[model samples]
Target: MSEPIPTGCEGVDELLGGGFERGVVTQLYGPPAAGKTNLALSAAVETAARGDSALFIDTEGISVDRLEQLASARTEDVEDLASRIIVSDVLDFDEQGEAVQDAEEFAEQVELIVLDSATGFYRIRRTEDEEAGDALRTVAQQVTHLLSLARKHDLAVVITNQVFTDPDSDRARPLGGHTLTHWSGVVLRLERFRGGNRRATLEKHQAKPAGETIQFKITGEGLQSVEDVP
Candidate 1:
């Protein structure tokens, strides 16, 4: 079997049956300040430590400073790791679609691809456009194209998404509707936990059982497992 991509958290890796598997889309959805981006960055740090490249398609203006800080804790040659990460910043729906589609070309070269807050652009478009179905469909198509790239190149695809509370259950739901939930192979839901830690729940997965949760915290070094906590 191929080696699974680590998220830099042993507890999370165990919950995920040895981290994320390649050739599938992994959705990390949560509310604001849930450390979703931190998890993605931690994964990138692990990839860089392995001497591999990863692509970051940023829709929410990701912080390279934070990335450098995290990477520095893992390796002394932070510049070498930072150089391997290629970031593409997209400001609008059209540009976001283009950036996602562009991942196909770099699929073979990079071991991981992250679209931090992929639904942010779509959410904005929906609010502004009166007839939003057409725009949403276009974005959906772009996501499908990226999934194809993941399978074709056997790369780990990590996509972050926003969440809204369901009125009925009072639980958080990923805002992309069925268009996202149905397409993702693994869906991990994150929420704030006690003691400044974050809880990651296995909402959906192919191999792992659902409803399992793990604790992690965003430390100066990156996402440190709860076991490492003092």
Candidate 2:
């Protein structure tokens, strides 16, 4: 049997069959202010609190101050948790490649690695004139390499993605397309409720079946589980 994975959120862990699967990529996708970053940060904090190290790769210029704020706002103790979490930012694919290598080397001591908004790297690497197809291929290569590294080091991988409206259809979709969905073992979608509350819905899972959606609320103390509203 595969080793157990722990979800940062309590209720989410129960919904995700004990937790996310180890040595696999899990994608968290949502629109702006949809609590994607909040969820990722929560998971990272939980991993660290459990005596495991976690690495956060910030590509969208998520400032150190912002990270500190999130860390401090964690449901768990911040000072204790911050020591176990490391943060890095890369400007392009080349930088990302190097960062991945460094993360692999560090994974010997770290338990989890998170790429906060991986799509940002793709956007930075893509030239204005480049076709979507070419850019996607480049992103695919990088993600594949990272996945390999995660597997080799037995590190759990978490990636956050931005959502976009699919003009051709009514539903929302992740920015990177099929390459992302195919590579990730789990895909979660987050949105805001009528009262500005957050909702975390499991959209897809390759490792196991995710039968129902769950509700979550964010506060100064951090993410808290809520009953699923009908």
Candidate 3:
């Protein structure tokens, strides 16, 4: 069996009972500046640092500067590690679907698939049809496809998402709704923490109880546990 993959964060790995399972899908959601992209990039960095490949199908452009900064501390040759990490950017939902389909080509070499912001275009292209019938269906189909790829290839999958404000509760929730929550094996909600840090709450998990919380800081060295920094 493939080994469970570490997310490059000690606290998150602890929450997952070591790390992410090969066939599981992890969903990360949070407000702006909550470190979603940093987490996603860190996953890629972790994979590439291990001399494995990662396919990042991005709906938004990745931050190259941040990626370099994260990789430098882990490996002597940041360029080599970055080379093993391939990035495929999609402009909208149609392109996003196509990108996932094309990802199969790299299955043999890739250990992880990070789909950053799974619902970017869905949010933008959503019709006045409040139910978003057709759009929601697309999200379901694509997510299922990604999960199937993970299981068949024995690779991990991580998908980030934007948040939507719940009018009734005045809370921010993951954008893809039940479609995302149903398929993901683990779901983490990131929020601002005290002292320039972030908190990750295990909102859902297949094998673990929910509501576990951990606080960490993001820096050039990557995500660091700040448990003692009260």
**At residue 114, what lDDT does model 3 achieve?**
89
Clashes per model (N, Cα, C within 3 A): 0, 0, 0
Off by over 4 Å in 1: 227-230
lDDT at 2, model 3: 77
lDDT of 2: 0.75
Per-candidate Cα RMSD to the true structure, in Å, reads 2.0, 2.6, 1.7
TM-score of model 3 vs. true structure: 0.94
Clashing pairs in 3: none
lDDT (C-alpha, whole model) for all candidates = 0.85, 0.75, 0.86
Those runs of model 3 whose alpha carbons end farther than 4 Å from true positions after fitting are 127-131, 228-230
Question: Which candidate number has the best lDDT?
Answer: 3
lDDT of candidate 1 over 1-230, digit per residue (tens)? 36778999888888888887788888999999898898888888888888999999988887878999988998899999888888898887778888887888888899899989778877787788655687667766876777888788888888899987789999888978688877789999998988998989998999878998888888888887785343
Task: Report how far residue 200 has shifted in candidate 2, in Å.
Answer: 1.9
Ranked by lDDT from best down, the candidates are: 3, 1, 2
State the lDDT of candidate 2 residue by residue for 142-198, as single tens digits. 667668867887777888887677889967889887889899888888888766677
TM-score of each prediction: 0.94, 0.87, 0.94
